[model samples]
Target: MMNRRDFLKLACFSVVGTPARSVFDRLTGKDIAGPTKEGQPKWAMVVDLKMCASKPGCRDCVDACHSIHNVPAFNNPKDEVKWVWTDSYKNIFPEQSHRFVSVEVQTRPVLILCNHCENPPCVKVCPTRATFRREDGIVMMDYHRCIGCRYCMAACPYGARSFNWKDPRPFIKKIKEDFPTRTKGVVEKCSFCEERLAKGLKPACVEACTTKALTFGDLNEPNSQVRNLLASKPNIRRKAYLGTEPKVFYLE
Candidate 1:
């Protein structure tokens, strides 16, 4: 006789190979058509590391993103981050070795944010349609629809998502009048400035980058500036081993 857990696993696996339409119906109580446009704008980002080293205006990008998003500013690790952050080389990518004194990767702060993968595992794992991929290839989170499960956070390899562990209203200061404030108990990540994009503007972070380290454009467009930048510059993605095929690229 099959155990209950094993039986459930088997049942789920049975549906794994089914069409995405059926999967959507089963999970979301509705069927969503796959994207219609074959070559719709697929925005990707490239961070130029050479220009990022001790860069003067680097924080401007982060500040501009936070200012526009109405993200809370609580220092407590539990209630921090929505759009941008800084991570050291060692923290972002720890060296794996048996040697006791491996030369510390010269610590340089890298701006960290959501990669918005072409194939986001977060979208697949979300039981609610709270998190979904947009037609423009941007991964968006609908805070109102979220159930605070944090499954998307666990599924993401890049640690891009943050959860609201407590009420966020108190932490916000001088809130942006136009942006909606996020409530407690939802998973949030960068949206690549979808609102701005809709207004025919670049992401605030990209616009704030004085050194032009951040580049955003349609990866599907062969002649797009971002594609051209990638072609000309050697770039890499975080956690390539996971095969996420992240839209965000980094040029070192």
Candidate 2:
């Protein structure tokens, strides 16, 4: 019984109304609601300071992590990084210029990478669920699902995520047997070797460290070695003031 113009208007309204209704539902958590499954274990890492030394050949951790992750070796800063690397204070942590006397410590190269925060701001800011918090308390990224928005990268306070500006496959030579190659225009970072962890193996970086400086275990587990180590040693997390509550701990 509707006229031509009235029918057309009704159709347009229906189309618009459907999307608006969907948006309202999403806001009410009706779109993404899900039940949390029990028995999924949470994992965390603790780095022991007393055991870690900044000597040469001590970069096994860096080498191991990079090789396993198939990270590109771009000397230029523009195209670099994936999993792990070392950075000096002058490089990673610079002193404030306004401060009269900077007490900034220039300790040996601290192996710097993702902290995998328990409550990751990066995950919350990602428009695409590319970066998400796993039930195990590890912050993970699904590069395949990522839309190259770079929102998660910017949201990260720790500078953990790296953007692949170009094709990474060409730079990687003699690819490690365990790691997979990443493509361009995606964000990547350390996943704490979830693949290895699934196999009941330690992270490549932890295994590669000759000094056994890196400790990987469940921080939630009271009887774990990392927990015991924290009890005995004086440790600090990088930028605790940020309240990221990083799983990686450093010994002073």
lDDT of each: 0.80, 0.74
lDDT of 1: 0.80
Please tell me which predicted candidate would have the highest lDDT against the true structure: 1
lDDT of 2: 0.74
TM-score of each: 0.82, 0.77
Residue pairs in candidate 1 whose N, alpha carbon or C atoms collide under 3 angstroms: none
- Tell me the tens digit of each residue's lDDT in model 2 across 13-105: 899989988888656434332233465565767765436654554778877778778988877987776577766544444532233433344
lDDT score of residue 32 within candidate 1: 30
- Name the weakest run of 10 consecutive residues (lDDT summed) in model 1: 96-105
Best by TM-score: 1
Q: Report the C-alpha lDDT of model 1 over 71-183, residue by residue, as the tens digit.
A: 88888676676678777656665642233534443356677899887668888788887998877778899999999999998899888998988877778877888998888
Per-residue lDDT for 75 in model 2? 73
Model 2 poorest 10 in a row by lDDT: 95-104
